[model samples]
Target: MVRKHLLAIGGALGLGLVSAGLAQTIEGLDLGAIQSRAVEQARDAEAFLSAVSDRGKDARDEARQTVDESLAAVKAIDPTKLPKVGEAGAIDLDEMVSGAQGSLDNPRSAPLFIAFASLSMPEDSLKQMIADVHKAGGVVVFRGLPGNNGRMFAAAMRRVVSQDASGNVAIDPRLFRAFDIKAVPTYVAVSTGFTPCDDFACKSRVPPFDRVTGNVTVQYALESLAQAKGPGAPVAGAALANLVRHD
Candidate 1:
């Protein structure tokens, strides 16, 4: 009877071990529903990332197009409105002084004179002189000198006269002549008929001082002219003398 009881006990322990093993196997298996849900979540995340990337690309394309359009608009602006050389701008003394004729019928309308050794005068001084002439209701004619300073002097005159729009000053090389120009940088004032005159004379009257030095400053000449009395004399001789001295 004892042997029969031992066999039954061993059989019962073997059946309990088999049932534990089967329970462990069932717990390890993956459910189809859980796997399907995980795949759907992964697909949603991928779609969200793709949409963000596409939006960024679209924004970049729009920005590029906007920049291109802006550049095109700038390029399309009209260039004619800008100032150009040789346009109907202010008259330059250099260009005008050339090809000038001494017989410019309208003397009072515009002052004309043949500059002797014009290149000897400084550009600033010449410009100032031209401005003075303009202020005195006259135009200037810059005649070319035989020396190398001709072009340089004319250029200086051009720089100053170009600032005014009235075209009051002009330069003309054609007016240059080999006359007895006793004084260099001589300024011969003219009247309504364009006739040349000195301090005391307009129509063949003798100048008070006939022998003026070529190197004499404008101040010296004006002072001498102020002391004399005649036609073509300085309008306000004393005032002009004072102005030249101070200048």
Candidate 2:
């Protein structure tokens, strides 16, 4: 009886975690729907546990198979193989500043910005955009793991890096919320000494910045920002000059 209960609990928990991970894998995915499905799955797991007493091997086998598959999928992602600046999936802002074209006493003093993107975008376009951002000393930020698995993220990143050798990729979901980014390939050039808050709901005061959203090239976006003469204009202008000089 204890063994049966343990199995049921483990199966239910695994299903819930897997469901959450799967939902997060997709860009702009809805978690509410995934949570509802997870709840239904938990109910199904309970039903399977009850069915066990009635000699219902079919239900038990099906539930076990599902749990096994889900676990396998989650295990497939290996974070070790993914390219990281300091820690796996976490960006080291200090390193990002050092490799950047401009010199700054404090890492945050530079008008560091993020190019919000996703792995779901077109391969050629994504690669080109990454290359452009790298040239401009901007970081490419992904909201989360591709397919909610580290192995898949690593594999996808390897393909992108192979073409552009863009090593400034970072995975941070908070930036999405902080910047209120609703679309992919959005370019945000923030003012100097600007720092995002740790809490998503905190709504800390964000420094002045210029933003461009669309499928436009980074050069076009920077030109628009520089012309706007916003708080981020000088930084954007400098980056634009670097891009042009290199071109």
Candidate 3:
């Protein structure tokens, strides 16, 4: 039954109908919510594995695989709940790219800051930030991390947005490679989509980019990124700083 349903979903996606249904379904699935739930499930699985004494290494590996597959299934449904790539009033990446292509035909808009990490940020903080972005007419896309930290983070985000109705955020790993991230906890504001206005004109202002290490927190790093834009951009700088301090 699950396979059949998945197949139907795939068909829908292929037909471009998935986007229409996605926005409505995504209203309840927020990034923070999903990650929290995934973390809990992973802890439970760990406890179960620890209790299984005398199990061969192969057996344990198989059990872990089963757990992972179950988790993946849960995550698969997330995208459907979000709005399609070009829904009106929604910050659709597709639309952004299209508009960018036209406006930045010469030089692109400022690069978006991309962060890749394995661990989830605090649920309350992350969710609130996501909510703020949504209210500000922005979109967030969460991708799966590589190791335990990644899984836990993915789970937590899943829990927060599972019931979302906007279909604004997404959690997928495929998009990660496209950004060419080097470290687990890294941020890079890219300029891939925006084209320069002309040979000498830039589309959006490019901000300074830097990386931090150890005990890294999402809110703080995001705040720093916003601040890099300059003090005059009160909305981004002030909002991010407030979130970091509060978190």
Candidate 4:
């Protein structure tokens, strides 16, 4: 008889509402005021849960949109367009090979790295910088001016380890705007999407890039990156030190 009364309490009252309905029908209980308040509280709880669910959906949508934008921004280049050798007398044959252990792409990839270098940079400096990035497991993409020396640039690259021959390819102009880069030879540490960046990705907690100039050694810049990666081959003393010591 008591169960029959709760079943009749309009459209499933829920645990809270069911309790209220039972208390309401209790003989001589006179709990009408308390039962009415319970209904309101139950409704409020349901609404709050629904709102939390909606927020989760919105957050997922935001993540999807971000991934799409990053994919659209990525660009590729052909190595055929660049020179495979430097000027007849420009290269120092002895210092060409990087003595660092492992290949150029051997660094830990938690925070993706892509170095934007200019054609205007001196032959020796650019070569050393490229080697450093590679030894530290970063990618190199070259940018040239209206009168840049593509031949010498290509020639210099032939000496260092350029993963996938990307060193011979030109930089995508879109990368400049994405990272807000105003100069060449910028070592931008990016997030997963290769977005141009001055610092480590915010969510990733990686250290940001230190744009290299004549004042600072390229090896130091690369070493800093290896250290930021924490425990890994990039942090190994020999490989990391060799990257800076080779030059």
Listed per candidate, the RMSD to the true structure in angstroms reads: 45.7, 15.0, 15.2, 27.1
Residue 241 accuracy (lDDT) in model 2? 87
| Per-prediction TM-score | 0.37, 0.56, 0.35, 0.36
- Per-residue CA lDDT of model 3 for 107-163, tens digit only, reads 323224334443355555555545544433333444432232322332344444322
Taking the tens digit of each residue's C-alpha lDDT, what string does model 4 give over 140-178? 554221222223333444544333322223333334445
Model 3 RMSD, rounded to 1 decimal: 15.2
Candidate with best TM-score: 2
Clashes of 2: 1
**C-alpha lDDT of residue 108 in model 3:** 27
Q: Which ranges in model 3 have alpha carbons more than 4 Å from their true place?
A: 1-122, 132-139, 145-158, 162-166, 172-175, 182-186, 192-219, 226-247
Q: Rank the candidates by TM-score, best first.
A: 2, 1, 4, 3
Each prediction's whole-model lDDT (CA): 0.33, 0.53, 0.37, 0.36
lDDT, model 4, position 125: 73
Model 4 has an lDDT value of 0.36
Q: List model 1 lDDT by residue over 3-84, tens digit each.
A: 2211211111110000011111111111222222334323322332333344476543443343233222322322233224
- Tell me model 3's lDDT, rounded to 2 decimals: 0.37
- Of the two candidates 2 and 4, the one with more favorable lDDT, higher being better, is 2
